[model samples]
Target: MVRASACGRPFVREGAVSAFPFDAVIFDMDGVIVDTEYYYLGETAAFAKELGLNLTQEELNGQVGTSHQFFLRMLVDWFERAGKGHLTGEEALIRWDEWAHKRPRDYQALINPGAVDTIRELPRRGVRVALASSSPMDSIEEVLNACGLSDAFEYVVSGEQFKESKPEPDIYLHALDLLGLPANRCCCVEDSVPGITAGKRAGLTVIAKREERFGFSQDAADKIIDQLPELLTLS
Candidate 1:
């Protein structure tokens, strides 16, 4: 068994490829790295309420781990249900974004416990790190920079660049391609059902950060951990 020391170098037995089992790790930003999923759900529900749409939390939860385009379509469907069918998905997204910007969240304060330490420590354990998020690149950059993680990942990919998002596995597959690692050689950290499904579909080990809220099921994940630094215990 290999173990990584908190402060010193990782320990490995003879002929071990590395202290960590995986060659690389790819992280998801929202619920896994930062505690922004709850905030986003709140914002989504509030925005719908302001529009008199009365969307339930369960309804907004459907948008979690989705691409920007998929979210827009969800907004359109929700609005149409509230008799606002005249508004297109794009128009609805614009309105929602404008509303959300009025009271912007401080992303730095939302960094999950041990997230930074875990990300920084993985490389020290002989693992390369990357990030793949359903967020647009601008949003990804903003969160990363705010959390003082601008240099954290060797590569960062956004689902906005792909034709499909999480549940479709395109983003994670693309991240694997970018890292030049096979899915079996890497793992993905995620908290949402769609993200877990994506990682599994991509043939990577999916480690879920336990998330009981938002009516999500993480049963599909290969492993579950309460905090980011728990990853250090693997292998």
Candidate 2:
């Protein structure tokens, strides 16, 4: 349970994962479970376009892994900057959610390859599984339900449940508390810099799902894997 360097030392090799050292595995939802990070940006850009605003990829990149509250505030600011009529963050969120729901993204279709199998197989291998996502509760439920994983996790937590999310470590710390396991006894699976930083700050071993499209750096994690099922090969 020693902290590895930013070099991201491998916790395991191409061997059986049943010998996995952690007591529990906490997952981040967006890019870890589903490739929604990309789609979310698309939705955001589309919504912004409807408001006569065009957001660059660089601007949308900053929104990755951030809490919904932070995203709403950013959206409000963007709207005001675009002369789209000044609106409160809450109002912007409501409008955004309304627009998003109208489009109705197919969560099942967006699920990352091997993600569902990885989540479902973990508990059978004697590893407890939980979800800690920055998405709101309703959105979390939607994804879980659509992915047919409503009962898959021992616990499911949302960033909206806390005063702050990711990079702040509050969400991860609360998740560890709820799991009743010390950080050393558990690990976090994440993809974004904020999520990895949160796990590290919470004192858990962070395994990042390597992401290249968003210009994210996975160097802060203890390990990096190309796919979710790679967890099954850990030691």
Tens-digit lDDT track for model 1 on 6-110? 122233323433478798899999999899998988887877787678666677787787777788777787777778766787798787788778997899999
Which whole-number lDDT from 0 to 100 does residue 52 have in model 1? 78
Error of 2 at 158 (Å): 0.5
In candidate 2, what residue range of length 10 has the lowest lDDT sum? Answer: 1-10
Query: Runs in model 1 with CA error above 4 Å?
Result: 1-18, 82-85
Query: Lowest summed lDDT over 10 consecutive residues: which window, candidate 1?
Result: 1-10
Give stretches of model 2 more than 4 Å off: 1-17
Report the lDDT tens digits of candidate 2 across residue range 1-235.
Answer: 1111112222222333467778789999999999999998888888878877767888889888888778878889878978878999888887777777789788899999999999888877788787889888888888888998887777778898778888889888887777778999999999998899899999999999999999878998999999999998886
Each candidate structure's TM-score, on Cα atoms with residue i matched to residue i, is: 0.89, 0.90
If candidate 1 were superposed on the true structure by all CA atoms, what would the RMSD be? 6.6
